[model samples]
Target: MIYKVFYQEAKDSTPRREQTRALYLDIDAQTELEGRIIARQLVEEHTAYNIEFIELLSENHLEYEKTHADFSITEF
Candidate 1:
C-alpha cells in the first residue's frame, strides 16, 4: 500500500525556527500499523524532524501523476 506521511518540523522555543514540510512516501506493507512503522523508521533514519501526522493516500499504487489545463470563457 501507498501512504502519504504529512509531517511538520517540531516546534521549538528557539531563536531560529524551521519551516513546515511534508513528505510523500510509497510504503509497501500489509497493514496500517506496519505502514506507520515503516514511515517512522524512514523519517527517523533520514531526517532530524518529528512527524505531525501520517495519512494514507492510496493503496496498491506505485506512482503519482499530475496534469494541468487551461480554458477560456466569454459572456455577453
Candidate 2:
C-alpha cells in the first residue's frame, strides 16, 4: 500500500510548542475497507491535536509519504 500524508504546522495558542497535523491520507491498499481502517486509526491517534484526514485508495505499491504544504497549493 502506498500512502501519502499531507499536513500542516502551526503555533498553538499555548506557548510550549508548535503543532504539525495531518490533513489527509492518499493510500494504495488491497481493499477499500483496509484503507478506511488505516485512515481512521491515523485520525484516532492524532485526535488530541487539530488534525483532519482524507483517504484515497490505490492498488500498486506500499509506500508512505508525508507533505507539509498548504492545501491551496496542492492540486486535488
- Predicted structure with the largest TM-score when compared to the true one: 1
Where is model 2 more than 4 Å wrong at Cα?
1-22, 49-76
**Candidate 2 per-residue lDDT over residues 2-69, each given as its tens digit:** 33343334325442324444354554467877876776566557554433344452433222233333
- Residue pairs clashing in model 2 are 1-62
Candidate 1 lDDT score at position 54: 72
- State each model's CA lDDT, in order: 0.57, 0.45
53: Cα error in model 1, Å = 0.6
Look at candidate 2 and tell me the lDDT of residue 3.
37
